[model samples]
Target: MSTTPTPTPIPTPTPTPSLTLTRPAPTDNPTKPLIILCDGTWCGRETNTRSNIYKLAELFGVRIGARIQSPDGVLYLEGVGLGSSFLDYIFNGITGQDIAQQCITIYEYLVHNYTYPTHEIWLFGLSRGAYLARAVAGMINNCGIVHPLRIAGTNEIDAPQTRLLCETVYNLYRSPYATNAPHAPQSLRFRQTKSWPLIGDEDPADRTAPRFHPPIRFMGLLDTVGSLGMPEYTGGVGLDWPVFYDQHVSTVVANVHHAVSLHDRLFVFQPCLVSRDHARHCRRDWERFGVTRQEWLPGCHYDLGRQRFRFLREFGGGWLESLLASRWFGFASKVIEPNHVLADLALRWMLLAIRAQSTTVNYEVVANIERVIEDVTESIRGRAREPGRTGDGDVYGHVLSYAPFGSLLLDVVRTLRGTRGKVSALYQLFFDLRDRLIPDDNAVVYDFYGFDEDIPGCVGDLARVSERRYPSKSYVKWRLRQ
Candidate 1:
């Protein structure tokens, strides 16, 4: 069953934000939307993994404090990074329990301090943080927010004991060991542990700890590696992934954005359980609207987050990781100079292709990306044993540019317009095959988000080959091979 759809609090009567005022707000206005950022393992508040989150916080925090209305209409943003200290990594990073615990803080803030119906919530995270965001969304949709036993006052932070209760609430919704916990039937824990549609004369309007809730506005992620922090010996809490599934959450979110790395190979990082299950559930939600989308780009898990949080590794690096493995391994090192260090193992660790609709950017320029990937991958496979594959051959550089894609799109549309009702299996078959590699419609599309100008020099280049999308899909379609 799907998670219960919690309507976002959009007050019917919106008070005009004093757009002309330049002083600190007298009282926090209900119209303000709260934006929260959760960081990945070992990279929370102190070492925020994504730079964009930090920038957004700094930029918006000032505007809100100064009583100036932001163009985006956001007035508040919360940034939390899990496993910020060394001890936390040693203790809780593996299971990503610390982050789950941290999400309790978000729960309290929304439940007690910002419960107004007008408040909207936006969540952004990277890697482990993304998993936490997904789990939180599912929890909110299914069990609803839990009111704090004791929220900190206007000037104070939550007490340690109160924070613990928040974690207990999240655990009840998603942690591996929450359901069977023994608690008094009258206690908050007892109510929270129960599933959706609370019993008795029930409705969200009922004032209670577990039933108090908030609506989500958006959730955006970057390469959600849910089990990355789990210890390898345990093979991780694999079955527990059902706890973070987003199917039940489809109705609660207005948008879901995911950016993944096509070449990250840490071995420890595993794809989110939700991504594996999307085809059966969330895919339909996405095709009908811009509600769910994930764009795949070249790089590793960390690199995708870097596209927004930090800098790209080579040519133009905005993000920095001290680990040599994260910095120069695999396809990333080939940005400027081809990396022969582990060239033989390139495709062995490739991530699957992605699908998403394009907005605020043009996809026409990248129409031939599929053919380019195929051509380059084949070349690398043929020369896997060469001693210095990255040197002069420049084998991985340059995609075959098949002329301007805009014109090609127009030609396809014109061809299809005339054959609407009649059965054109030949055209349909060709399109079906070609679409697998490159989609003609927005049903599934790949995107390079916020990565236009700073493409790293090591990633190679593109060369225009023909004025066509593909060489008829027959030249290399051993499956559809001419």
Candidate 2:
């Protein structure tokens, strides 16, 4: 009877912490920063154009030296631009097969080489290369990176199967419906079955969501132009090529720095401006965590990226060729030479941006950037001190004093079209016709940052001078309402 009244209360059981799979913690090994440089259309390391992307790669190689091949050193890869070869150039430069193949190649490299959580990925590109860089980042966001060990799976024979699985992931990535939802069933199942475990905390309630990995550390782009399938000659074409709509600058990238050409007015080379909402979101993130900048700088497409035609060097040598190479017909050099200074300024700005993120990059890269900054600063100061020089006079003076042959050709076209030298009306007619024929969301008007905004501190003086320089008259005329 007493035992029944004095019975001890049963003890409450302590719950054991639930176990969830996660990416392995980064080891003691130093981070191996993977730098991928994508060149603009028809540009590469071997090309005479030598875009900023190429130069940056060369600089990284020079600085990294033997370490580039070491496991602990920076990993570097260069994607030859879209139209780098004759065969590649045959399909209007935006062929889906070429782009998809390039993306796959880069993806394969990451799968085979990248060390999850211990390696950083950085991207640098110019023009269409910028578009390609964004596409690669988008692919990683849509399809989480596969574990390198899982790719080989303790045996070499599994490579083909791994590759097939990679293709499957990419095909799923290309599907709009699969990526539109945060936890699309198909993508989630694929990731859970084929890729590495999600890198962060897992939520049991939302287990179906696909979690991406190996965030892009930084992306530096120069004038991203996403006019897919728009032929260079016609400016608009209704081709059914795969358009990369997911390549917009987004938060998945820890940092983004875009150097835009304030004077690129070609209907086919319209500047791809970041959306106002995205910019604001990036600004908020910058205030709290990282950096994102889109700066407008002086120059045309080639002027900003630095392209030199190799036609004469490639095929000119005979007496007839010499005549074409003479000063009167030396349009190739004249077209690109006067703009080098402005291009260098842009390069300096980008190098400074890279330097700012030096913790993730090689120390030698930082050193090379400093040296470049010194050289460019001295050049700008010397030019600025010239007796008759003021503002961008040295850069744009040639254009004003002596128009290039292409300018003369465009003038002739304008006169033939009966525009009576009204370049704005001529360009307006072309744009209006393009809009009417194949109206597309990608055909949005160009929106540029004010010349005075977002100037890098290192290039502040030079930027002011560049701002004074006159932009392309035609570009100024074609500045459409956004």
* Strongest candidate by TM-score: 2
RMSD of each: 18.9, 13.9
TM-score to true structure, per model: 0.46, 0.64
Local distance difference test values of all predictions, in order: 0.40, 0.54
Candidate 1 runs further than 4 Å off: 1-30, 44-50, 62-97, 148-165, 175-214, 228-248, 273-290, 307-482
Q: What are the per-residue Cα lDDT tens digits for candidate 1 across 79-124?
A: 2223134334334644665555556656655555444345556676
Clashes of 1: 21
